[model samples]
Target: MTRESWRTRLGFILAAVGSAVGLGNVWRFPWMTAENGGSAFLVVYLAIILLVGVPGLLAEFVIGRRSQRNPAGALYRLSSGSKSWGAVGLFGVVTAVVLLSFYSVVGGWILRYFLASFTGGYFGSPGQYFGAIDFGLPAVGFHVGFLALTALVVVGGIRDGIERATKVMMPAIIVLLIALAGWAVTRPGAGAGLSFYLDFDGTYLRANFFDVLGAAAGQALFTLSLGVGTMITYASYLGDDHNLASDGSLIAVLNTGVGVLAGLVVFPLLFATVGELTGPAAAGGGPGALFVSLAGAFSQLPFGQPLAVVFFGVIVLAALSSSISMLEIPVAYLVDEFGLERRTATAALTCLVLVTGSANALNPGLFGFVAGTLVDLMLTAGLAGFLVFVGWVLGKDAVTEFSSGAGSRVRSLGPAWLWSVRTILPLFLLGTLAVNLLALAGVSLF
Candidate 1:
């Protein structure tokens, strides 16, 4: 059988964006923004996205499209006489498993909340509703259901499963979000929310510049699906006909737009209802925020139930789209390296994740560590390795791949982009990684 590829360029773009826009956009981005200095943090994050994120994404595309293999195989083959390079790629495979272990559990919670809303399950006390359904056997069951949904897509292979699903999902997610943001902005006192979200308090940023920089940089990479080799794997499916630079830029822009749109709805609603919108609850109930608070908001408003359905439905699609990418990393590694059948690889990986994800579902501290700090560290390191490989190892070839389908304007900029990736980007990532590691050790870079 021939290897599967995306049916069209739009299918590929939507699929990549689907992986980019997920719980990171809906659940975590708001919380991170609220905890940081709000708009000041947003500004820094946006700057990083434009400067660092786009180039890094292009680097991944270069590797993926050039090698046309899983990260492990891509690295080993792209660099001759380097088993260690494959080991670096294996780290990404491990990262995917670690990412999905907690991600699926959270996705499961979204599934649960979606179901709960229609039945008015948590309508009585919205505050306690999150706690009630957060973790237990039921949570595990729903997580398994969500995991099964993810597995089904992976089993369906790239074309039938990932591409087809994401093409529909990404559009639906955008449409629903636009509608929600429009509705949210119209509410009385929504200006207070917008002010709180958009207020640029320089003092807050000046006070926590380094900390915010590290956090925002990490968020920008993770939210764009840059570091995990998802981009590499996705790009591997591309034929030599596509322009990697254009595709990378499009994915980054669309993902960032959706993330900002999410903030627009969430911040305004939280601020309009109650002043300031502090802590995890306002941003997200950790994992439950989107379902719980949004559901609460819906219950109190007219047409709340229908709107609740739309919100959770969007989340379900977004979560699945991203989760499928996560699952694909390891499954592809198994197929490419171990020569396992795709079905066997997916099934075996799904079972392994069932155990790993269940552990995340059963424990809060472990889940927090893996989902928050661990993922940040892993993605940071993974992306740094990819950029270094492209910048130094594949330096000339990287330029060629980048300029292949790019217009003259973008192709012209490839050299400068390559220079930055080689020197400046790596240095910045190393510094951020050191700070994050030290902060984890209680050294307090801030």
Candidate 2:
């Protein structure tokens, strides 16, 4: 059987951007921003994306394009058949599964909202509606429905499925979001929300530096779709003519733009309706809170039913785009390592996620732990492993791969990029990981 590759550079870029810009941008980014001092979190998040996210992304690309294999195979082959390093790659594949298990439940929630918008089902009492449906048989039913939608696309193969779908979804998401943002900023009380999002607070940033740093770093990795081998899996489909640095940089920029745009829509809607940025409705209640808050906001606005339809529709697309990437990671592993057909691999994994995601949908405590703390730790640790392999295992060869298919200016930064991956990046990631683990254990470092 022949392996599939993306048909065009444009297709690969769009697919990558789609992978990066998902519910992480639309849902989690706003919640994290609101919880972590708003603009203060934004400042640290942007810095991490620039300094850590891009470099970490390129490391995965180097491993993928060089080996032209899934994350496990890439690491194994690159390290001259080292089972240990290959296990690290396999860990990434597991992280993707963990990601989708919770992520699909949220996707289901978005789907319910998208459908309900047309009928204004939740408009009367958004909070009660969410509380009733958030965990139970209804959540499970929607999760399965959402998982089915994700499976439908992945079974289509690279060009015919993932690439083609993202090309359409990415553009629609951007245009709709811009339209929404345009409308949102014009609302009666939007300026307060905008001020909260855009205005910097240096004192808050400094005082909560460690706490914010840990949260910001996790959000940065999560938003970029790093550390789960999604980037590595996606890049494995690339052709050599594509420039890794330029492509990676563009993905980061586009992903960050979408995240900021989501906040513009979310925060303004919150302030425009609720008139404040605190409490469970604003940020505290996690994913469930965000849904209730937005649903209530849409109910209060004029033409809100139509606007809710459009807003939830964008989220449905964004959710599918990211869910497909997460599903693709494990599917790629099965195909590359076990020689399973794509359809068979996708079918098997879809069933697995149906069970796991149902557990998330039915249990709030499990969902919160997996979605918030566990994901952050896994992604941080996963990225750190990939960077160490790139720096120590691949070494100079990693630099060569990083320099492939690039202009003179991009090529010049290869050594520095490699050096950082080898030293600075690993240290930073480990520090971040330690902070997160400490936080998880109820120990405050600051």
Candidate 3:
């Protein structure tokens, strides 16, 4: 059987960008920025994205395009059948499954909220509404529904499914977010939210530099969808004609813009309507609390019902975009490695996630562990492994792959990028992984 490839360059770019722009940007990024010194966290995050994120992205692209295979096969073939390196790639496959299990639970919550918005179902008691539906059987049903939607797209093959869906979804997410941000900033008392998000506090940044750096780096990698082989799997379908550097940089910029735009919308709405930005009931109170707070804020507005519909609709799209990518990783692994058909791969993985995700939905303690601590560890470790493989294993060949289809200026930075990936970047990732592991074990550096 022949391999699938993206139909066009634009299709490929949109699909990749869709994968990057997800709940990480819309749900987590805004709250993280507020918790970490606002604009100070933003500054560090932008630096990390440019310095670390792009190069790491290009590394996956190089390996993927060079091999034209899934992560496991790509690493195996590229490393002369090194099973050790192949396992690293397989680890990414596992990470994707782990990610989707908990992520789908959240996706289900978003789907429920989108539908609820139309009828204002949660308007009476937003906090109580969230508590009632956040777990157990109802949550499990929604998780299955959300997972079904994700599988529907993956079973369609490359161009018709993932590529086609993202082109529409990405545009809708961006345009809706921009509109929301514009309306949000004009509300009374919104200036306080804008100040909270945009105003930099140098003293706080200096005092809590390490804390801010760790949080910023985690969010940067997560928002980019690195380490889980989503990028690698996406890149494997590409032709050498695509400029990996240019495409990667554009994806990062667009993803960051959406994250900032989410803050613009969320912060102002919280300030103007909810009149709070911190504490257990505010942006920092985790996803359930944030959703409840935002829902309450929507209920208080003039065109609140329609605005709620649009806002939650944007989140649903964002969640679907990333979920599809997560599902694709393991599906690609099976199809590439075992000659399973796309539909067969999709069905098998979807069923597996259905069971795992239900476990998460029915158990709050398990869900929190997987969603917060477990995911952070897996993504960090997975990216570290990928960087080491690209640097030490691919070595000069990595540069050759990166330079292909790139301009002179981009080509010129190949060696510097390689050195960073090989040395500095791995160290950075490993350090982040250590911090997360320690935190999981009830140890805190800060």
Best by TM-score: 2
All candidates' lDDT scores?
Answer: 0.86, 0.92, 0.91
User: Please, what is the TM-score per model?
Assistant: 0.97, 0.98, 0.98
How good is model 3 by TM-score?
Answer: 0.98
**Each candidate structure's count of clashing pairs:** 1, 0, 0
Query: Highest lDDT among the candidates is held by which one?
Result: 2
Candidate 1 lDDT by residue in tens digits, 309-401:
777887888899999999999999998888888999999999999999999888888888998899999999999999999998899999998
Stretches of candidate 1 exceeding 4 Å from the true structure = 277-285, 289-292
> What lDDT tens digits, residue by residue, belong to model 2 across residues 295-341?
88888889999999999999999999999999999999999999999
In model 2, pairs of residues that clash are none
lDDT of 1: 0.86
Candidate 1 Cα deviation (angstroms), residue 350: 0.6
Residue 382 C-alpha lDDT in model 2: 95
Q: Score candidate 2 by TM-score against the native.
A: 0.98
Query: Which of the two candidates, 1 or 3, achieves a greater lDDT against the reference?
Result: 3
Q: Which candidate would rank higher by TM-score, 2 or 3?
A: 2
